[model samples]
Target: MKRSRFTEEQIIGILREQEAGVATSEVCRRHGVSSATFYKWKAKFGGMDVSEARRLKALEDENAKLKRMLADAMLDNVALKDLLGKKVVTPAARREAAAHLRSAYEMSERRACRVLGVDRASVRYQAARPGDGVLRDRLKALVQERRRFGYRRLHVLLRREGHAVNRKRVQRLYREEKLSVRRRGGRKRAMGTRRPLETPLGANQRWSLDFVSDQLTDGRRFRTREALSLVVDTSISGQRLARELDKLIARRSRSAVIVSDNGTEMTSRAILERTNRTGVAWHYVAPGRPQQNGFVESFNGRLRDECLNEEVFASTAGARTVIERSRTDYNHVRPSAHGGLTPEAVRLNLAASRLRNVTSCAGRPLPSAQQIGHQTLGLS
Candidate 1:
């Protein structure tokens, strides 16, 4: 390294020698500083008194130390312009980051929800769906009364009443409100013998029938079978019956075909004669093959799950009341997967998706839909 032109003591000495009138050359040569360097120092220190120079030097030193500290902090990720709004919640930060990432993978919302540990619904967004409070309330009334409408049928009803709505939005809001005619449930199998029928292709084609049994806290038991009469119309879902065994079709034209297994009540010459008397076709699946009657069995399992299973009924009347309430919910409020549309709405908007395998694409038939006596959601 090159030697410095001036030293602290030498600089002071030079200033002192200049004050004493010593030859500048002798002072410069003694200090090992060239004339130019000497003059530069003189100019710097000459006007400022010694105390000011020292104070300025001290300030410079402090500034250099602060700069080094700041640089080190930057390297270690600690340097920040404003510490405000930093991660107040460490765990929440991780969760929010996961939520943002989940927003990116729109294809797999469940996976994203798992990664984020958030409700799948928080990530599976349906865009702005405005509800006309009055309209929705009215619809809710109808749903409460019917309890088994899919969105398509609801949409038609709504249009007739002058409430224009997007069926898809209705489906989303229906789920968010959990106001569908049916309750939700997990996967399960059926009880007893049944058959699986192909998803229907036309309206008024097929209907499913099943009974829901519940026990009262007093140990009294009651049974009521919901017809779950699905009206298929070249679409997966047509309409739901939720019809109790007591209901009679005063207007026989409402149902064209009835499909069921050889249950005692259904096989009783009485029920068979009833269908024959109504001029409706009756189709029965071979025994032990519930898949042949997939539609109603699915409904039954759901009835058990969302209604019978979600809660414990205290009495026969309580079970009946709860089942009736859930029936209305199932018909009108539930979002469905058969078409990624409610069973009611599948006919108009997502009809294309009907019968296209909601549980999988490989088309594996779901387990026997004949769940009875199990806690289920709707129609069971």
Candidate 2:
């Protein structure tokens, strides 16, 4: 370092002269310092005697030395951190350091940790964690068993099996072992919004019609008209379907609305003309979507599962007998999941409920079922 022209004592003397009202220019000229330098000295050494000024200089020298030492220590720390980042340290790094210290310098584990600037517990850490191996084996077995299940399902199963592990731990191991299920590639189309099928409050208010086909013992195919009443026959044509529907409507009550799919037999001219003449509203479900007509589809599924699949029909008469018996049992004997009542009981209950406040087409009291021939129609 270059030495200063004036000592601390001389600088303090110049500032004291300025304090005693001497001209600043005269002081600068006498000291051979510029007015700016005089002002700088005044600012630094203002209101101090020579002793205090020398003490301040000594304190500044000590502070500079301390700062230089601090900077050197910080540089060493930075170097160590960088080396550690470049894979200089592993989980076994601390143990090796401890062992080196013990062999080379005869230092204990505690002294080695202090010298190496590492945590004591980290230096003493064991390679195997408690139950880690067993947990990994269980996770692998579970993944193999449930090929389609994901991490969430595995976590649930693990919990059910009395494992006290958390979902995050399971997920971490699952990723490490590459146990994720392969996802299907194509974008999946969504089924449209599902709405419940309309239920009739009375017998003739609404009716659902669907056609079900089955093979006889002789391998000949036959279709059944499933509606309020099932009509089984060998051959099913548009005209035959229309005639059967008309007869069903007459035998039961004339329906106001009929729900069905857009099948050829249903949309034929004969069936359309019959619906128009009878003043019945025909509602067709969306094409290729059978779920929209869930009522008849569900009934057909039940008939197939319970009766059709078990019985082998020999003749049309035998088929009709078996189907009629099954239909009767379904209507009168089997308790429906819907409202905990049989189909017949539900119809009767709905009719009775509406009858308390219902009237007839002529605005007259409708005769009871006992008085009429079981063909009473209520206000829709």
Candidate 3:
């Protein structure tokens, strides 16, 4: 059974009687309330005196008014449901529904009336196909290179890249190419999140890793793989450390953390477990966001443009030899915008300048790529 609210005067009277030693049962019966109700009122007024009760009366009245307002609001909602023909008890049925569809066809009343049931005179699709092959290729290239594009964004990009593509055609192309960013319907929540990291500074700081495919002349298709994991100290001009990567990082045990984005090989559980055991921290960048591991992606682009794309491998060993050599050149001669010096030159200077420096780089050292780059009898 539901109980009703007791007024401040009623509470004061009840408390006064109970304090004067009148039995609670006798007082409750006289007041026409249950003993439970009387005790409840006692608890409410037990600590407060008459002055405090008078002071809080306005607050109690305001609370009552607010509760009425809430009930009225709920009633208005129910009345709206009746007015809207939604008497269904299912809350799911009461929920608002919305669907989003965009028609970006380049068509007239004659065409659109065929595609959609609407009259052509009421249509807004373009009449002619914006047949710009060059523009399409450019957009596709940019999308591939950047790995992201939506209709509006692609429109802006095309405009900047000298393509006079309109938003409708861009939308059409985006849908056709499936390049539009996927959208999901839900309430959006605010979350504080970090952005993608760019190139890192400092040796042994960030190493980017990824794999790429290549082919041999004997019709053998294989992946031309690379682990361009360079930890350049950005403070020290983010120098590229080029050398035999195997010699430098291949050894077991005793090092700082090495991070890689998951690319099958990098995601190997063995690598994860081993790193854990060896006390070398391993971090995997989230998938699809290569800029999260920008160094490796940048390195992959260079490897393709400079080495793999330019040459056809005779065999895996020959390919390896060439790749190793190219890496040496990349390390020693190619001035990294991040790393000011060649990998070889940096390593040499590091050894000479600092004590207790160690890398497993040792061999019959070939002539430096720096020497090759600026040759006078193969030396300056």
Candidate 4:
């Protein structure tokens, strides 16, 4: 019912004015009300005081509230009867139940949803995500090729292929596809005081050398010497080691220091002569302490785990080819810990930054384009 504009006290005062012999038309005109409305007010509150009128309003409010409660109880009872023995746990299931109630029982959506305990928004929700068929296919192919790669590495590969995907999305898809790499148990070692190794600030500033060995199909053994700064050379003798060292120095420029374990080839007179000729300091770790050259040791561990254990080479030539391809990927394709960039990309970026610093000194004029080109070639 619509509420009256005049308060109960004001109505009583108006009635008293009428009782005091004021004209009815004058009273209605003074209050800006119609005669019909005045008459209705008179019929309802003619003899009642302000207190009685307030009490009547309070009773009316309580009665309306009770009616609403009764109606809700009836709705819940009917819904329970309709949904007997049916489980509605998920939002989807609740939405389905509400939809069934609306269609089968001619119930309104608001009432049906209230009874089924579902949000109206959820009932109207529709999935609008794009399909991932192509992405899933590509992800599976990468997993097949690099069986030991984790989702983080796979995410980097996908980005390299121009996929514009998020790492979390790749992780979700990886879990959904069950492509997790199983971790192998490690051997226990003697506990000792651990010290963190200092990281090199630039490429070719420090290099580490280590040999990784594997067997051919006929059980013949071969070894590959890996330079932890992204160079690998296959050699079987100390003489070949010296030649490879010279080739590495010529190709990659001289390093300030070379770190290695105290193996015979690394400590040989030929290697010492080569280092002296190139003016490169060769630092040897203590005997039986491979952890002193941790960088190359870590690389050898990964090479053994990810490549050597997975491949069975039939000949030395095939082994060299496969190892060379792996080295290329390690430098140019595989992601490193350096902000997800490959080793080659990191090296190029560092070199470019250094060249910019050299050519753009604060008080000096910019170098010519020819000089810049020469610097670029030298850095490369």
Best by TM-score: 4
lDDT of each: 0.53, 0.68, 0.51, 0.72
lDDT of 4 at 144: 91
Clashing pairs in 4: none
Error of 4 at 284 (Å): 2.2
Question: Candidates ranked by lDDT, best first?
Answer: 4, 2, 1, 3
Q: Write the per-residue lDDT of candidate 1 for residues 1-380, one digit (tens) a residue.
A: 36545545557667878779888898878767789987888887775666777787679779989998787555323212232365624444544544544454332545444544556554454548455677668667767754656666666567657776778766755665677554465545456654334544344344555444555567665544123432211111111232322253543234556666676656666665556566777677776666676655666665665555566866555665666766655554555544333444434332244456444524543222221111122222
- Model 3 clash count equals 14
* Candidate 2 lDDT, 1-380, residue by residue in tens: 67788999889888888889999999899879999888888888888888889999999899989998897566545544544544426657667756766666566777667767788898877767565677788999987755555776677667767889988999978887899866534323337866566544334555667877777899887787122577777777779877776777677757777778888888999988887788889889876667776666666766665567668999888888988887776666554544334557665665675677665423544332222112111100
What's model 3's overall lDDT? 0.51
* Candidate 4 Cα errors over 4 Å, as ranges: 1-126, 186-190, 225-235, 359-380
The number of clashing residue pairs in model 2 is 0
Which portions of model 2 show Cα errors greater than 4 Å?
1-201, 225-227, 357-380
Best candidate according to lDDT:
4
Give the count of colliding residue pairs in each prediction: 63, 0, 14, 0
Q: Kindly list the per-residue Cα lDDT of model 3 for residues 165-245, writing each as its tens digit.
A: 688987866666777544323333333443555332223433434455667888776554123332211111101111222
Distance from true location, Cα of 139 in model 4, Å: 0.6
lDDT of 2 at 13: 81
TM-score, predicted candidate 3 vs. hidden true structure:
0.35
| Predicted structure 1, TM vs. truth | 0.39
